[model samples]
Every structure is written in structure tokens, then in C-alpha cells.
Target: MLSDPSRKYRPFPQVNLPDRQWPSRTITQAPRWLSTDLRDGNQALIDPMGAEKKQRFFDLLVKVGIKEIEVGFPSAGATEFDFISGLVRTGRVPDDVMVQVLTQSRKDLIDTSFESLRGARAAIVHLYNAVSPAWRQIVFNMTMPEIKQIAIEGAKLLRDNAAAQPDTDWHFEYSPETFSTAELDFSLEVCSAVMDILKPTPDHPIIFNLPATVEAAMPNIYADQIEYFGRNIPNRDSVIISLHTHNDRGTGVAATELGLLAGADRVEGCLFGNGERTGNVDLVTVALNMYTQGLSPGLDFSDIDEVIKTVEYCNQLPVHPRHPYAGELVFTAFSGSHQDAIKKGFAAQAQRNDELWQVPYLPIDPADLGQSYEAVIRVNSQSGKGGVAWVLEQDHGLKLPKKMQANFSSTVQELSDSTGRELTSTDIWESFEKRYHLKGDGRFRLIDFQESQSPKQQDERIFAGKIRIDGVEQSVSGRGNGLISSLANALESALGGQLDIIDYSEHAIGHGTDARAAAYVECRVGDGPVLFGVGISRDVATASVRAILSAANGA
Candidate 1:
């Protein structure tokens, strides 16, 4: 039974047709999901998922509607085994849910792995051994016939182990490790022999998971392989055909979907494709693919934020900010054209859901992943009139004049690319006031000023400020309700401009009493007398000086 190490022998050599494109027509329905984040993900960790984190993640997996979760390789170590024990003991596992444990076909490992499922409602004992010719020669150091013998022996051991745990309904799953690269006939023979000895019933059907351990070829080759096995494998009607693929070639999801079309009934993966080397296929991406087509993912991952957070924390890996569905800025639009298109797309979609079908602006709604519409538009260098005006209307309740919107759009873009960051709503105000209203030369400026308040004076809150304008220095005076307004009025007289303070506020500069006070004002424009300018400063006199100059220049 020695496998052909040459790998040159062809199994139905002619593949005849080219591989189908992604977003395949054959990939219509979602398959049964099996999350191996705990088992497969754990093994890949430099600091493996500890007992507490593993147990918590286990509960989260089940609660998220993953009916069949590969808990861990119980036989690998005591921590995984103990973690499994705690999972079963808590009685938190749903009746319909199945706790799956992985082990090699070796007798000692199989026995130890089964010990973790003493009282499970129903469970799968997953066992495997290397089956490819290269694995036989290099890794296992066994001949093909020796691999067959081991496969048979492993099946018997798994059968015996399940029989001992008959009190809890048990099922079995066997994988021909790296079956994608193995000789077709050899894989079928071993899997057939194992199934015959195991005899999986309809109530507890066995699963034959063929893993493309390394993505050596395109998805179409994998599809042809699945189609061949599904068509030729004996009693496959009583067994489930499953797929476990990696992302080494960046087609793990593609391979998985086509494998299903070729007759795979289940998929095994991690949440965000976390695994060794390239990583396992991402279940979230595949599941949401189904959602986009209006099909149920079967698992309740509607609140994907919580799931992303939990996985990010458990793996101690940060989710990439641009990662689809779970990224911080996946739906954010910084380009003005993009924002305009997205906004219009949303408006059209709002009137009717079907109208926005296939809008070029967005492939998925941000809200679907619990992101807000606000995140959909960000003001920056590439931002446009629609995006900037949108921010103004939303944040400041100020409607941008049509001409003003046009003028500010270019300036906003310039400021954004210059800053190289997301511009806040406040930045928009500063941009407008600086470019237009505050373009005046600083011939006159506030030097120093301080004021003391006596609450006993009804409308006589005393205000004092100093000004040095056009080589002339002056001390000004005014009577107003507050320090900020009094400072503005006195400075307007010294500079000879009409002062109308629309809004006034102060902010603490630092932690303690020595912290300087900053002030801001919306003052009436003096030249055109048709607009307003915003002024800000740490010193009240400086604020008034700038506000008057801003209005004079703007006027």
C-alpha cells in the first residue's frame, strides 16, 4: 500500500476547464461552520491561549451559534484537556451543540482526548494522521502500506473510544491530512476503510474532512478534487464531506466555497483567518458573504463588533484598520467624490432598499456591521463640498452658503493633505475663519490684559484689555455681562470696528490653577458686514484683537 512518492502519476489527468472566477455562481449556500480558533489558533500562538482565555473564548464561540466547535487538541497537553473538562462540567453547552476534540490516531492520544468528553450531550472525536506520499516518506517515515495500516488501526481506536463514551452520543470525523496533494485513489481507499469500520449512522453521520493543508494549487483544482471524491466515494450519502483550507495562496475562502459547490457540507476555520504561516480561512468573511446574498449565515454574528473585539483580545492581535467588515475605517470616505456618491447612494437607498442595489459607492452598509453613518464621511484633503458641508450641518448646525461651500472645498482639501490627518468639525471652522475672515495683517495685536469679576455688580462686570495697533498702544474699557464680551467690545473701540459677540466660551489649558484660560467668539464681519468670523486665544485680549482684525479683513 505504498503511496506514489513520485506524485507524477495522474488521477484523471485532464482538468478540461478553466477555474471559475471568485464570487462564484456555484457558491450559493453557506455550509456548516466549525470554528477551530481554540485548537488550531492555540497551537500557532507564541504564548498559547491560556486556560482562562481559552474557556472564555469557548463560551463565546458557542454563544455565537457555532454548533460544532473544535475545542482543542486535548491529547496535546494537560491544559487543553483540563479546559475541555471545565467546558463540559459547566453544563453551559447547549443540547444541540457538539463539543469536538482533536487527536492523532495514536492510541494513547486518542484515549486521553476522549477523557475530556466524559458527559457531553453529543461530541465528535476528530482524528487524523499524515496521508500524502511526501508526508509518508518525510514526516511519518512510513510506506504507503504502513499508512493504510495506521489508518485502519486509528479508525478502530476511534471507534473503541466512542463506544466507551456511548453514554453521551458520539460521532467520529477523520481527515486525510493534506488530502489535496495525496494520490486520489490512495486517499479514497484509506477513508473508505475507516468509514466501513466506524459505520456512522444518519443520526450521527461521520465527516470526512479533506484539508488543502498547503494551498499548492488554484481553487478549481481543489473543486475538481472535491467533485471527484463526492462522485466516487462509497456511502458518502451517509457521511459528510468537509473542507479545511489554508490561505497560503490567498484563496482559502475561494477554495472553500467551490469545495462546497463540489459537495462539501461543512467548513473549518478561525474567525479572522488566524493560523500559522498564512493562516486558516476566515469564517467571518465567508459567513458575511452569505449575508450579502440575503442568505442566513446560520450563526448569529449580527453584532460583529463584539466578536472582533473578543478575537482581537484573545489572540493579542490587532485587527487591521482596513480589514473588511471589522476595520476601523472600512466604510469611512475621505475623498469628496466618494462621500458625495455614498451620500446620494444612501439617500436613494433610504427611499427604497432595492433602488441602491449595486451602487458603485458602497458594497456593504456600515450599519450592517454596527458602524455609524457618520464614519462614512471624513473631512480631509481629498474631501469635497458635500462632505465638508455635511460636517458643518451635522456638527455646527450651520448651513454652508452654496458659493461658500465651493470656496471652502478647495481650502479644506488643502488643509487636510497638509495636516495629514482627519480634520475635526472644529478644524472646518478654523479653516473658514482663517482663510477668509482672518486674512488681515497683524498690524494691531493684543499685548496683555487681565480682569477681576465682582458678582455684586448686576450688569457691571468690569472688563479691561490692552492693544498695540498701527504703532499706537492703548488701554480700552467696556461694561458687559462677562469677561469675554467686555474684552471684545473694548478692543472693537480701540481698533474702530463694530463688535457683535455671538458665542463665548472658555476652556482650561492644563490640570491645575496655573492653567491658562482660552476664549473663543463668533464676531460680526465689518467690511461686507454680511458674515461672521471666529476668534480663539489663551489670553482674552489676544482673542479680541484677533476677532477685530479677522472681521476687518473679511469686511
Candidate 2:
């Protein structure tokens, strides 16, 4: 790293538009989207998609509701030309979807591009040439007039070819390739010259795709540039402004959004921002961002997992685990506080009368993208009582009491720390069974239990039960005000200790005749620490009795 970076680098200049309307504008609708996964994205891949993968990806893009796709640069080679030709020859292109092919300003390449789309019902011919000063002086060694003539000559070729092929619905797209860093007026001049040659009307508009070939400035500056062009360009109604931004500065998506606000009509990018250098603007992020803002993005990502799988297979690159809406862990929460808030948010969302989605730490609902809630909250050493309880309730249908949640969380935390790894729902459930003495034999086991009301005192109850203590059978009896108290009295008398019931709770685990009651009890024996117990049975009374015995066993 350089100590004095300013000496070697200069800050990008800002657009001189103090009256920029984009700053106050909001995106109310989705712009037209064009996926370049087969062209720009394929060119950037280490192992580009073969014919089969390209066909599969094309089908996927169609399934996801993308109407415009840049198929490939037909003039690149036989493989590129053959793929575009195959889509046309086989009649695979849908009636509503338009396939686009790229070409340079050369007449031979333009002829090849059109030949590739010979029999297509509708197609777009995209012609691009570098117009920036750096490109003119360093790359091409040409002046501004020379660059403008190149664009004009290409537009002429496009117009003549479309005239010859009247049966095909042809749309023309002209890109001043380095528009982001080029002089705005020079870019406007080149586009205006092309428009004059194409002679586009409002019904047949010419697309002027302005690309941030290398993102150099802030997103707001890019918006200013778009606004300035839209305000000054001739025949605005006959020109569709499109944005193709690269992620050179990691702001391609932001630039595209701001450009939309600046009155641009379309966007072009890959599915997961796959392209040259850092990558192109992520179309998924831009579209879903609109979805979150209460506007329909016009694209369906409902089965996002399938989309990820297809994109990964075609691109041969894995989507980052933290990618905006499609990543695997985007819906998961491991932090204690985040999990607690999300648990509470789900509860509140379920009880709401309206359809608005509101949840903390999650900007969009995972279920909307075909993801289940089971992965939303996971248990780890960093998890708290609420997170642990959430896992139990979601997986096992046991809503532990507030204090009991805290009590059991410590046991889970100890195991998590010892194992030094995340715990699954099964691990948590098994630990719960062992902690509450709900599994296997314990110190005291109930063989039979019966209770009846006292005739002399209606409020008093006589409790009698047979139990096995360390393999020894015995009869125990006591009198108390209620069934629970009477059972406590009998246990204390036989066990030789003062047993106190501090807390007790019970609920049905399921529905109808098959339902079973779950009971939880917190008990203190003599001077020992309070212990928790759990029991489940078809009879509520029996479940309570086993709960008390389970707590005693803990003592």
C-alpha cells in the first residue's frame, strides 16, 4: 500500500448538475431487465458454459420470467455463432422473449451477428465501441470524430441489414462502451449520430446502453451523469436508456439503481453478479431490493434454491454464503440476540391481521423464496435461553416455562462449550430428556397410584400410591388439601425430607384423542438447588405425579 496514494491517483470528477432530479426521485416500478449470462458472464468464467449448459441456462432464465437475454457475441468464433444459430434453427426461442447478440463496428462481424439470428421472430442487434478519452488516446489512438464515425457507420450497417431482413422483428441497441468515464457531451453526440442513421420512432425505439465498463466514481455521480444525458439527448422518446455497470468499485448495483431513478429504462447484468474483474451488477440483488420496497420486480425467484443450483452449475462458481437474498446462510441466525429477536418477530408476524412482513435482522421472508423456518434459529454456544426454547418448540412442540428455559439453557451451553461445535435439534432434545429424567430408570419409580375425596372433610383428599425405591416396593399414604399437595405429602413422608413445589406447568402436546399431556415441575429438596423435571403421558394427573418423582430423583 502506498503511504501517499493521492500522489498517484486522482479523485473522479462529479457531474455538474445541481438541479439533479434523481436525488429526490424514488424507484416506483421495475425496469426492463436483460440477462447477459451467456455473453459477458460466460466470457469472464474460467470454464465457460458448453452447449448443454448454455441451453439449460437459457431455459432457466426463461422460467424465471426474463424476457430479454444477450445470447452471445456471434462474431467471436464458431462455437458462439453456432449456439446463437441453434436457438434460432431449432425454434427454441419463445414468441415473447427476444434473443440479443453482440458485435463490433466492423461490417463483417455485423453480418455474422445478423446471420446467427437469421430466422428468429424477434432479436436485438447490440453494437458497441469505446468512446472514452483514455480509450481514444491510449487504446485506439483516435480522436473524438473518429470514434463518433465508427458508431455512425455501425448504425448504418444495422439499418441496412434490418431493411433486407424485413420478416424478422429487429431492435437496435448502441452502446458507447466506456460511457461512465467518457465526456458526457461526446457520448451524447455519438448516440445522437447513431439515432439519426437508425431513424428510430417512439414505437421502434433505439436502445442507447450506457455501460460503466469500469466503475470509477460514487453511485450518486453516476446518477448525475444519467440524468444529464436524459435531459440533453435528442429524441428522448425514441431512445431507451439502458445501464450496464461493472463492479469495479463494488458499487455496480448501487449505480444501476441510481441510474434507474435518473430515468434510465433498462438494466443488463448476470444472475449473481458474474462477469469480468470484480463482476457485473447483480440483477438478483437489484430486483429483490425492489420486491422488499413493496414493488413487484417483475421476475420470479420463488424457487431461489433451484436458481442458485442452476447458476452455480452453469457458471462453475459458487455463490458467496453471504450473497444478498439467495445465499444459504442469509436466513440463518446463530447469534443469541439476533435469534431471540427473530423468534419474537415470528410470533408477532403470525398474530398480525395485515399482510405486511416485519422481522428483525431479516429484510425479507425466507418462506417467500421457498425456504423453511427450521433453519432460521439454530443452537450454538453463542445461543441464549430464548434461542434454545425456540428450537425445542419448533422441533419438538415443547414450550418450556420462562425460568425453565433459562435452567435448561445452561445445560445446553455446557455441552456446546465442551463439544466446541454447534448442536442440532436432536442433540438438544436428547439432552432435554436426560436432564429431566424422562428416559430410562430413576431413583424412585411409581408402580401404581390412586386418590379419593375425604367424607368428613370435603376439601381434604386421601392419596395412596405404591412405589419402588431402589428395587424395593412399599406403600405410601398421606392427606392434603389437593391431589398435587397430597402426592407431595406422601413423597416427603416416605423420602424423609421436606419437598417444596416452587413451580408447575402443563400443556397438551398434540391434538384430539392421540394427544398427550406434558408436565414440568421445579422442586427444592431440603437445602439443595432447585431442579426441573418433565413428564409426558395420556393422563394429566399421572404426568404431574411422574414430574414430581422426576424432580425427586434429581435431588
Candidate 3:
């Protein structure tokens, strides 16, 4: 035993169970999730999106139901002002959507910030200044009293500008820059001074945002500061306390949760943590943190993929695969053990329909974010039977009986070994269908077809068709006024029989002129209707008939 050169050892990385503390309350429901994706997210970009891209991103934000969009910091730079101008000139902004403009407490910037929102229906003018001891000494070279003066002056400026816009509603928001690092008493003093000068009414409540700009301490200390402010801040009933934390501690989410628990009401951050230095708190992670806990984030950001695309496009940034919720691989498992466990968990869950088991395999269903279920359980070197089966069940809606799982698992292992790359949800679905689907080599085959319409027929749009099922040239025709109806008639005559047309859909394959056209249909057999399949071709009618045969051939 002593002569053995190699020793049984285990060494890599291990998370100490004792050090882990899953926060009791995940997210505060009462707070509004004001996405700074367009502003902060844009600033974080190496190649910041221009006004057009910004507008497109803004449209997506609005579509996703984000009520408060930090549209821009019109005071900062030329590009920003131009973007703000575009929003104003086009009259593109929605009535209910509050356009938030950020600016410092400085006179020029405040003037510029207000100038940007001239024609806005409603707006929030956020004024901020550095007030921490270190910030005062290093940046402003000012003492605490001097900083307090600056805050009061800034507050007065905001009040005047807001008052000037009497025709439009303006809610005032003040931020004590580097708040987490600032002395608690000093922060309270400046924030209180600000509120006093502004004199926030109940109808338009004042918001005091404490930012952990340079995180110099643990999350608990930050929580303590929030609690102290929450308990001590005067006229808080007539105001809303907000938090903006950074990820220097890698505990932005944790800090945010603690801060809210200690009494902050609003959160401002980028979609996936894009900002100065290490970045501001990730709004997606923070917002979804509450959403998963059964709290409404006041924004319907269920389609996370679309959200990420907008963030990526505007910020010109790539999301870390490990990032929570919106990351490319957040819901993906590529480890052998993880995949195996997930596969088993899904199997167990499926076995007992009587019990709804929201298992650990996926923290959140990708479908919740408007993501298709295909990518949930992907196959890789780390994958096994359970993972493969889950992939099939979720993506294809084809329940993989446990017996077939082993073979599929083997195929997944082979693919993973071959590629040396992680397969995406869409990739896995395509590969799996190609390999195992019955339609790949089936009895029915579509040879050709066509359709013509005048938009004149009642439920008929002039369709005709042809096919070569079992190599017999089956020429068929119909005069249905609608495309779907004509195609249904064409298929019935071609097959020398009739099948129920269950469903049909036509959509653009992709964007632009290069986009291939596609069509899909569902046909009923003896009982249930099965989804038909089709491919991209110039001939539209042929595509429709192909769709029917795909289902007829047991696709």
C-alpha cells in the first residue's frame, strides 16, 4: 500500500455547504422593474447601437410590456440627445410609457436632460451626484457640507425644471452616488435635503435611489445601510426608496434582495448586467428572481430570448452562457451527472401526472420566456438516457418511452463526442428528427402543386395540386376559394380518399428578401390530428401538399 505511486484523490472545486445561504425572500414584488437596457445597457457597449437600433430596441421593450424604460441620458452625449430627439419628433413614444432621462445634479446637464423631454407625455428626471467620503475627496474634492450644498442645489434645479413642464407630468428621482460606500448619516442628510427642496407630493412621489457604485463591502453591510435609511428616512410614506447595485462583489442579486428586504422599492439595471466597471445589477436575473417566486415584476418579460436579442443588439454585448435566466445555457445541462439526474427527474415527473413536479432539471421553463422547449435538455458528452428522452419529450412533443431512451442517449453521446461543441435547442431538435423520425423514409411523397387567388371567393382562394405517393403520379385538382381549402381538396383527390384538415399555418421562414417561404399543416387520421411538415420552395402549392404528405407518411 505504501509503494503505490498514484493515490485516490478528488480535487477540482467544491462549494462549501456552510457558506451557501439561499435568501429567504427572493424578490420584492412591490417594486417597479425599470429597465435601463436602452441607456445603461447601451453605455456598456463597445459598439453602442445608434438611434435606429435604439428605437428598435425601444419598440421591443414596449412590446414586452416594460412600463418604465430608462430611454436615455440625454445630458451625457450627442448621440443620446439625437435619440431623444428622434423619439420626440416622430411622436413614436406611447402615452402610458414613461420616458426616463438621467442627468447629474450639475446645471448644464440638468438643463439638457429637461430639454430632451420637452414634448414627452410623462417623464422622470433622475438627478444624481457623488456624495461618499472617498468620492468627495478624490472626485469632487469637496467636504460633506459642500456635497450637501450640491445636492440641495441639484434638487432645486430638478424642481424648477419639473415645474417649468407644468403641462407635462414629471416625477423627480434623486440618486446619492456611491451610496453603499458613503457614510449612512451623510447619505441620509443629502437625500433628505433633496426631498425637502423638491417637496414631493403624494400624487408624484419622490424617489431616492441609493447606488452601490463602488462596492467596498459585503452584502450585509449594504443591507444594513438600506435598513438604516428605510427606518430613518423622513416622509418615506410620501416617497419611494430605490436601489441600484453593481456586481463588484459578485453579489449584486444578493445585495438587491437584501436591500429590498430592508425596504427599497424600485430597481434599475440592464438586462444581463451591462454597465460601468463590473456592471450594474442584472435586471433579468433580479426581475426573474421575483417572477419565479410567484411575484409579478409589473413587466411581462416572459420571452427571454427576444429580450436577450434586444439587449445584445443594443449593447453590442454577448451574454455569458452561465448567466441566470437569459444566458444561452442557463437552462441547459451538459454535465454527465447533471444530464443523467435531469433525465431521471423528468421520467419520474412524467410517471406521476397526478402530481405536478416542478423538478430541479430546469429552474424555469424556457417556454415562459417565449423560448421553445426544444433546447431545455440537450445532449452532450455529459448527457445520458434521461437527458435525451427529455429533449425528445420537450422539443418534439414526442414522449420517449423509457425503453427507447438508451438508444437515443447513445446517439447523443456519439454526436457530442463528434462535435466538441454544445448543441443548442434548435440544433438538437433538427438532428433528432432527422435521425429517428418515421417521415424521413415514408410511404407518401409530394411531387408538385400550385395555387392562384383573386381574394374574391368565399372561403376559397383557388388552389390546385399534384403528388407522386408510392411513385404513382396522382394528378388532382380543386376550386376552393381559399388556399387551405383548395389544398385540402387537392390532397383528398390525390390520396384517392379524404382526410380531415385539422390545422394549417403559413409564415415567413426568416427576415428580408433572402427569407425562404414555409408552410405547415395538420391532418387527422382515424382519431387525433398530427402536425404536417413542409420545406422551403418557390412553389407555394407544392409546399402545402408536401406538408400534408409529411403527416400522412407518419412524420
TM-score per prediction, in order, is 0.66, 0.69, 0.65
Q: For every candidate structure, what is the RMSD over all alpha carbons to the true structure, in angstroms?
A: 13.4, 13.0, 13.4
lDDT of 1 by residue, 1-555 (tens): 448755764442534335533225456676888999999987887668777568667877987789899989887778888888888988867887888998887899988988888888888889898889889988879988899888889999988887777788888899999998888789998989898898877666889999998888888788888878777788767889889999888999899888887878999999889998889988988887777778778877766666765665456565566666766677777899988887887777778846445544557666776666585322221235655665555444444444446666788879968987556557877887566544444454556666667568876566665666665678776667766556656666554675675554444445455544433344563553443333455554565446544544444
Ranking by TM-score: 2, 1, 3
Cα lDDT for residue 239, model 1?
83
Q: lDDT scores for all predictions?
A: 0.73, 0.88, 0.70
Error of 1 at 513 (Å): 36
Give one digit per residue, the lDDT tens place, for model 3 in 160-225.
Answer: 887888887888888888887777888888888988888877676898888888776777777777
lDDT of 2 at 309: 62
Q: Lowest-scoring 10 consecutive residues by lDDT in candidate 1?
A: 375-384
**What's the lDDT of the predicted structure labeled candidate 2?**
0.88
lDDT of 2 by residue, 373-418 (tens): 5653222223356556756775677878878888898998898789
**CA lDDT, candidate 2, residue 417:** 80
